[model samples]
Target: MPPTRPSAVPPQGDTGARADAYATAPLLNCLLREVARPVPGAGEPRVYRLPSGERLLRVRGGRRPAAPEVNAGGTWHRVGHAELVKLVAEELQAHTGLSNPELPAEMADSRDAVAALLTARDRTTPPDDPYRRSEQSLLTGHPYHPAPKARGGGPVAAWLPYAPEAYAAFPLVLLGVREDAVAEEGDVSALDAFGTAPPGYQLLPAHPWQLDLVGPSLTDAFADGRLIRLGTTAFDTWPTAAIRTLYAPEHDLFVKFSLDVRITNDVRRLWRHDLLKLRRTNTAVSAAAPSVTPGAWLSDRGYRTADFAFEELAVLVRDGLHTHLAPGTTPLLAAALVESFDDTPLDGLHDPAAWWTAYLRAVVPPTLELFARHGVVIEAHLQNCLIAVDATGTPVQALFRDAEGVKLLPEVSRAAGWERLVYCLVVNHLVEIAEALCERHPDLDPWPAVRTAFERQSLRLDLPEATALLTAPTLPGKTNLLLRWTGADGADARYLPLPNPLRAR
Candidate 1:
């Protein structure tokens, strides 16, 4: 569908009164409805009583509709029919890939309905929507965008060309092919595509199931008693890791290859296994996506052989970078910075939101093209970021790594699993660390500064042209958490300052 102006409430006559009115509105009900909580009928909007005893209006339904439910006041409210239809259609599409039922009777009529909705967008009442942005634009950080075609070339110097000499440092080279290559190979193994190997070349079987989607390739290679493993450690979660490279001089990629997969799948050591596999995937894709650095697998199979253990690989990062900041100074330094300034953590967050900026610069436009105008909630924090600097202690790039650390909007994910994702990505990581910064720098607009930092990261990724996603939700908002946190002095900290206004709504 063509992009409509993002939904927003019109400015009222006075700023303070309007803000106060929104502050007293039934924001929680709005969030619940957005999350697809059932509501009453169409004519009757969901009437919710705010904490301050103010009343607010809520309705659901759009191109996709939410579940219908009865409200506490015994009044009837349903996800507005318009919104309900939209969300339900989206949900249906997610499950069966059919936006509407393939009913013989209404199939033809539904076309008219779709056309009307598309045409009458301006007249439609917008539903409760949260701030969101896309991240596919983030691919530019390290030059992972596919190289432009050579004017006239039989073969050009692409980064990972199929060559034997390039295989010297690492013996076994894992190559993942896009699905088309698999069909080209037919029944033949990935090895057959490149012709017979020179002496010391061995074509290990690519994972059988992956061969159809991601192309097959040589799994391992041995040169002078050294083993190099390649392609990827993960083949299922994503469709990409069809090949991996294991390369190290004088070390067997897997000393006991036969027993390796079995031990790593063991239950108890799962965390270690996840760490190794995640690190390995991060290493390869970082280069593939062209992020912070391109990390490849290396060999270190001797000392540890526990369940979830995978062989090690050397990831190629800039020479002087380390993952963390200077020792001991990290947590305290973060807190001290916030405290010295006398500002709150939220103040340091980005204004137009840095996550959206970098994502637009790095991942979108020419590469992914998934979103037209996106709003990505970056969720950057200590654990999700690497504060890399130069020789003079000047900050360079705030490396945003870890795919699992970011949260996409509910519309993108479809499932309402956002709460957990938000908890882990935003509150758990970025806010937690920013809280320390705020404690030290009380005078700073911590949130906006953080947003500015996100913008800096975006600029590093070459996204200066795109827009950012930093506007807070414009509707009435509130938060009512069920749990509390205890402070260092053992005082109740459960009544935390919640970020989203609609949380209580």
Candidate 2:
């Protein structure tokens, strides 16, 4: 189907096609990553050996992987998204004897959410700005996550307005927190500039989704004048891939709010412990970031919240893209750079080899530098990093964010921190990107550039782990399937070794 223009509605048939494609990608990713082993050599309908001996599974290939089938009775029986979820559930129950009633619904909800997004977007206009387009472009998120697109099982009417994929932009709902109840650290004064607060109150901006979730509980606070409805910011903010985080392009600032929704693995809440350590972690990373490159860390400067309703009303203020962005360059989401975008810098590359090299340079150096020189373990996953491109859309710089995700060295044992860094930086970040480049330009070999990027970096000589990374036979791949099935904390990442393509040929 052709791309739908703004104010145009796609035919019902096209919506279903898009929905299946969007929904199945994550399901296939989960199945292949957790239970299926390759059939060694298979054509078109790629075959895999399921855990239950001799039984085979087949799927159409692509980054997303689609059209799954199980070979039985000398025929391939097709499995739609619902059947796939059941298959996964049955398989997990047999494997672990664990039955999660919640996860299955979430899986179904994720697919339903995609169908709704497809249906809604057909009638709406995609963002015209390149940055906004890239930010709103993720239809299939966290490619390996089982229910990456799930919106906490909320109704389409409740969550669709806030979904980034639907090109959501809205003014932040502002509130006045009584001065005595306001507890903040570092620089949150920037938030106050969004709106005015009366003499004894401070401004607190909230994500509307979060407000919807927690508003009923705040009745007493409102009744007692502890919280006052001060209306919304004058301008609208774009929701980034991190749903709770909003970018106010007009002010060039970002506001991170505590949301109760479970996106991907974790309930998107600003935990009290994380809020307390926010300034320390941000300071450490900010101090380390500058030494690495012109690329920067948007400091999670500070937060504002009521002591009574702390995490519920908490908001973290961070620097915007403009200050950290390289001059004259357009910044794009790093994850979106890998996704299929109409005018992504990765599109129609004249020299993919050079572009991949530049991508490695812009992204890798700063990440490794923070780990080696400063003991800062950046969760330098694709989503956390942004690639800035020049006028012609060649990548020029990399910017990193999210203090909550960073693990400071010595704070976490060196070995433990390095493992997390490897999973996030190489397995989660670089590997997918390499595949994306290969997918875009099939004839091009992306690994040699990857091998060179890590092998020749001077910092690797200082950090012993970097040397091992290039020649290492395997890298740690996060087991998102098993994690969710076993009900583990999202941060408590369990990794299974994956074949390392960065090895010397």
Judging by TM-score against the true structure, name the best candidate: 2
Residues forming the 10-long window of minimal summed lDDT in candidate 1: 130-139
What digit string (tens of lDDT, one per residue) describes model 1 on residues 221-261?
22322333345332211111001221111221111111111
lDDT of each: 0.26, 0.84
Off by over 4 Å in 1: 1-268, 271-284, 291-381, 400-425, 451-497, 500-505
TM-score of each: 0.26, 0.96
Give the per-residue Cα lDDT of candidate 1 at 264: 9
Tens-digit per-residue lDDT, 120-193, candidate 2: 77788888899888888887788889898999887899989988989999999999999999988889889878
Query: Which runs of model 2 end up more than 4 angstroms from their true locations?
Result: 1-12, 458-461
Error of 1 at 448 (Å): 2.8
> How much is the lDDT of residue 160 in candidate 1?
21
